[model samples]
Target: MNGATTSGELRAHNRVRLLRAVHDGGATSTRSHLTRELRLARGTASVLVAGLAEDELLHEEPAQEHGRGRPTQVPGPHPRGPLALAADVREDAWELAACELGGRVTVLDVRPHDGTAEGALVPLGETIAAHTSRLGHRVIGVGVALAGPVRFGGLADIAHLGWRSVDVPALLGLPLRPAHGAGGGGATLGNDTAFAALAEARRGRLRDVRVGLHLHVDFDLGGVLVVDGRPLGGASGTGAEFGHMPLEGGDRPCMCGATGCWGMDVGANALLRHAGLEYGGGRGREQAERVLATSEQAVAACAAALGRGVAALVNAHDPEVVTLSGHGPELAERAGETLLRACEPRLMAIRRDHPPRIEGSALGWRGALLGAMESVFDVFLTPEGLGRWRDNHPDQGRDTPGRRNVTHSTPKGDQPP
Candidate 1:
């Protein structure tokens, strides 16, 4: 049998808990707020904050007085705290961002892509390298959100982009620099739609939801199931292919090697097809945007198909709500009533009266990037990782082997550098 927990272990656990509370609460989190949220005594919370500050993980500032209460310090990221780099790769564009601990994202770069996963690597690597060089040794890990099925640390297939069985980590060449903790940080990959679902669950509309669905309709429809604030990616990590479901009866073969895929009728390709524009690859999003801006009939068909697919998923999954991202929110805004009307005939009679609430994404275009940052934090914020970080930079002046001197600077906005 194992021995009972010691004071050191308990203190470490409480330290991680305090940091997590501050992280989840964002920049406005105060000492008193953390104390109440963690149900820790005021003195205990103070000690934890002091310890984190000493380790350069958090910074405290006098909070602005609001109502009648004693002044308290608001917690924020330390100047030398670890950072996360997030990348979102789409068909025509890619974005890279630097995210600090308190959830502040600074867009490092956004560049157009060649619509091919293999061709994207050179530029993607160059950009990541540039940012990592500038950010120095503070970057803890990288998270990538790809617009396709990711299987076992690689791309299973991106049908529209025509990529198959691509190794993403090999392509990106991760670990741009050494990490802060013992976990020896590298890169983490996820589906863009799943990452968006994670973003919604953590900081957006799905925060209050128990079971829900999130659909991001861009060049294609991609989504994930959010259960209890976690997006479930199945074995091999490419599970939630909700769009590939055969809800529409047709003979046309889908890019995903199936017939009558629901996605073929609900996204940019469908909208472009309805508008007599080209449907495959490259300019689908551009064409769909122009059509949605000019033509009403095309939008109507797309909206109807979108609603039908949503109804089918709802019937199968029984989620509490459905949140829309990418072009989904615009489609819902223009044809919400039509989408709801289309669902009425397909849903069960009991659900028809009280169907799942469909709403736009609160995080908007930044959902995937935010989720990518969250993924980085998820890997690095554990008790073991924190202990390693603390050990590497102990208060006693003896320099630890392999420890690099990380400089500090104030971050823009409320977050510390």
Candidate 2:
């Protein structure tokens, strides 16, 4: 706490800040705009951009002529800039996408499988290996969004797939070793709904909220509470399994070997069950949707159960807003009032008068996909991370964030007389 901040450290911090601005802004920024946003001098901003351009982290081009001021430079993700990779492992399918700094994602591949651990991860791993091999120089890391709780390092118990304590890492080894990433950190595992909630916090319905509740109701209900823009994973990172709670107090059995689970009364299973259809592991999704679309009574019952559980959560955590994802929007649209009525009576008196607003998902299915991408980007976009990358991949253009090689001094008439 005594020594002055090193110039190298200061430059590193500023460079990280600049990269973060573009990544979060989800679009390109001009030199003047970035300068204003980062509260840096025009000259300083230009220098930072140049260094980043030299490192191939950012691409610069002439700004289109529109204004009377001097021509500004536009900075965006370089063609060879670091990329964030994400995968979604569903009940019968898996998907992969590559994302640029500004959160623009391009889905690479999606393939269906036989619902086995190998059936899912094998094809998925192959796709990732093939893609990252060509894109390895830019890939930072990969994040996989699975349907069920992911605990420890390798064990995954996905009920739909009947995958119990599967060793995922053994099947899917290191995916990439991007030029910036030192041999990569392998795949990070996150629950699908939690990842969707993360996407919500970053760019969707839950964005900017202090405390938010995100519920995803597909074949079953699952959710996470986002506080300070993060999903609250418990001590073992195996928490926020809100679906297992029994708010309805029914004796219905659940797939998790528990009885009277709140999940048994909502999601696609609930809709299908109410319609007198046998709901089995992700197979009833389409049928459940059809039933909800045709049977008003089915939607009403499912929404009521959803409302009761939501009320319980609201009472326990007191979120600012509750946003729904997966198939929740369609259900809410049909039975919104019924859901509200069930929620209203259950709330404690204080929350009754002024209740939290329940809204639909803004990003829809894209939430999970984008969340997976952001999860990995969150790791590699740090100042320390960027510094390590710049160091490992030296020979970058002229100036580096950790070193001062470019002259900052501008001649007297260089101010654009």
Candidate 3:
């Protein structure tokens, strides 16, 4: 995908790499150090930075903390730079945010809706339309993190919300795609837990980890396997359904149409089941917190189940670490010891004393939204994607970076939302 055959292609390719370096480095990167990191000549780095500045993609200023000899240039997002809209669609509420490079995100809107597709998405679509219209072509793409498993082509099955085979893109009013290889400009749909796992790898506990398992446990559970700094998309882009793996071996008849799912004994529903409360979502999260606070027996049981099932996954995947998000942090805190006691013996005897750590996510609830932003940028930051962006924004050359009338995304690195 990065064959630089022509000079123009080579520039485009290097431009992407430069932007990625700035994004990954966040505020820590300087032009001088980027040259060393990318193994690019000083002049080439300067030229790339200059091109980006002139194109209204990025601008540089004198670095306060100088590296060595001369003053270094710190790259910052341009006022007119490309942005990605990240939406986290939950069982009860939806959150919309605008994001720029360097992993910055600003909450645009947050509201709950009736438990219907029309009620939930119509308002979200209206907000997206407002932002896109105000920002124009700088809005590159949109990414949605649904509380469900998303198929490779964006078919979603949100079992908790009682929705299946939902055409998410059409509902969100995404522009119709041209033929294949026509460049990237559309919405990216992915499972919430999978996207959260990616955010963990990029900016949270799983950062710098090679192989890691990340699970988001709310009412039920879902997950993704992050390997080599990337989220591994399994066959059909729907893998890591560890919750439905029957780890608990209970015939509780899960909402996923499965019997004996591991999720039956792990998430808020598991806690609620132990507490004699009906299973619920959204506002049910509040009920789960009450159970966690009041029922020690339920906490211990849930923790044990979480630990035991995680042990099984550790054996199967052998990840370096495991990160949990959503209500998982509280569960891990309340019964972490209990879970570990149940987990340690189940691992392969060879590594029983040194099993992978199970820690709460550093990104908290924002992981899914940030990961969705990364998904859009992952596609649209490429050479072809940028080419498409250029075609759409022909006036980019005449545009200048300005802060007036623009509310830039606040830079937040792994902070709780």
User: Every model's Cα RMSD, please?
Assistant: 4.9, 8.3, 3.5
In model 2, state the lDDT of residue 149. 83
The candidate maximizing TM-score is 3
Residue-level lDDT of model 1, residues 47-164, one tens digit each, is 8888777787877777898999789988888766778888888878888877777787766677887877657766887778777787666777788888888887455478877888
Tell me the tens digit of each residue's lDDT in model 3 across 102-175.
Answer: 77777787888876777787788887888788777888888888888878666778766777887777778885
**Which candidate, 1 or 3, has the higher TM-score?**
3
Candidate 2: regions farther than 4 A off: 1-4, 61-68, 175-183, 391-417
Clashing pairs in 2: none
lDDT per residue (tens digit) for residues 1-417 in model 2: 313299887887788889888887774577788899889988888899878888878876677888698898777777667777788887767877777777776667768778789888977888788877876557778888888887766577776558888877677765322222334457777788889999898888788999999998888888889999899887666675889888889997777878898887888888888889987666766788799899999999999989989999999999999999988998889999999989999999988877998999988877877887887777777676686567766456644232111111223222110
| TM-score order of candidates, top first | 3, 1, 2
The ten-residue window of minimal lDDT in model 3 covers 408-417
For model 3, what is the C-alpha lDDT against the true structure? 0.80
lDDT of 3 at 307: 87
User: Candidate 2: minimum summed lDDT over ten consecutive residues — where?
Assistant: 408-417
